[model samples]
Target: MLIFRRAKVEDFEKIKQIIKDCGLCDCDLERWLNNFMVAEEDGNVIGTGGIENYGEYGILCSVAVLPDFRNHGIGDGLVRSLINLADRMGIKTLFLFTDKAVNFFERVGFRKTNRSEIQENCPESKQLSSCPLSFIPMRLNINEFFENIKCK
Candidate 1:
């Protein structure tokens, strides 16, 4: 069976490997591992995702699934898990920088946003400052997401 849970320190190397395999950034991963979630199947780490908390704001980063696990809902599950974590942590808004998977994030309710918006809100975010200009910025309003879910 597959399990999703908080990433442990021992899982660090595997998580980083998966992230790198998926063509995502692995910079400063250790600093944020506490906030990461991993998908493990039969004792092997196949995917991971995490957030960079900034008080009421957060940046969802490093969401990745192994190539063999893509399209099996691992990525979606990881993203949903991170979103739930952010909600529970009182994050009001979430942002992300992605050069790929824009449609995937859109399916999860993240809308295209501008870099200036991210800089204005999360001035101290290292990811924001380092993300290339070609990357697309996306935002998700946590409160709105909850409200919409309630309505449905």
Candidate 2:
């Protein structure tokens, strides 16, 4: 069985290893641990995802699932949980940079967006690091998602 929960301080190294193994973006644990979550099974972490707050905008970053565990909805669960966190934090919009898995995030309501949208509103995020040209930008609004879920 898969277990999903908010990540604790102790889960960083394991989660970091998972991110590295999957070739996901690197993150500073000290900067992001509070918003990170992990999927575990039988004492081993199998997946991870996290978010970075930029006030009205949030960055959805570093979601990864083990290769052997793909196609089992683990990645979707991680995204949903991160979205929930964004909603609770009063984040209005969330965006991500991805070189791969664009299809995966699109299924979860992220739509391809102009790079300047992020660059203009979230200069702080761009200041944090540079995104490669190959990485496409995608965005979603937390309130919009919540509204759709309510309608459903």
Candidate 3:
């Protein structure tokens, strides 16, 4: 059976491997400590994603699914779970930098946004600075996101 849960202490290593195998982004232990999720199938981690908390906003990071698990909604599930966690934590906004997965994030209701929209002096802003010009910055307001999802 597949289970989706907030990543725990024991899940960190496998989660990092999943992130590496999928070639998403470097996994930061700090992000996992703050907000992270893992998709486990039969007690094995198969997918992972998380966001770096930045007060009112967060920088979404490291969303990846195993090769064999692609097209099975595992990635989407991770994103949804991250969004849910952010919402519950009183995080009002979530943004990510992605050279790829623009379409995927868009389908999840993340709209294209500019780095200037993010708060200055925050890690999210630093990430925006490091991203290549081709990488698109996307934002999602978790509360409205779920409302839209439920309406559909």
* Per-residue lDDT of candidate 3, residues 9-116 (tens digit): 888778778877876665355545547888999988898888777777888888889899899988888898899888887788888888878999999999998767
* Candidate with maximal lDDT: 1
TM-score order, best first, reads 1, 2, 3
Residue-by-residue lDDT tens digits, candidate 1, 1-152: 89899999999989988888788886368788899999999999999999988889999998998888899988988998999999998899999999989999998889999999889888888788888899999999998876776322
C-alpha TM-scores of all predictions: 0.94, 0.91, 0.88
Candidate 1 achieves a global lDDT of: 0.89
Question: What ranking of all candidate models by lDDT puts the best one first?
Answer: 1, 2, 3
In order, candidate lDDTs are: 0.89, 0.84, 0.80
**Global lDDT of model 2:** 0.84
Tell me the spans in candidate 2 whose CA falls farther than 4 Å from its real position. Answer: 126-128, 150-152
Model 2, range 1-152, lDDT digits (tens) per residue? 78888999999888889888998765555687899989888888899988888788888888999999989989998999999988888889999999888999887889999778987767777423666788889999888787776323
What is the C-alpha local distance difference test score of candidate 3?
Answer: 0.80
Clashing pairs in 3: none
RMSD in Å for model 1: 1.7
The regions of model 1 sitting more than 4 angstroms off are 150-152
Top of the candidates by TM-score = 1
Clashes of 2: 0
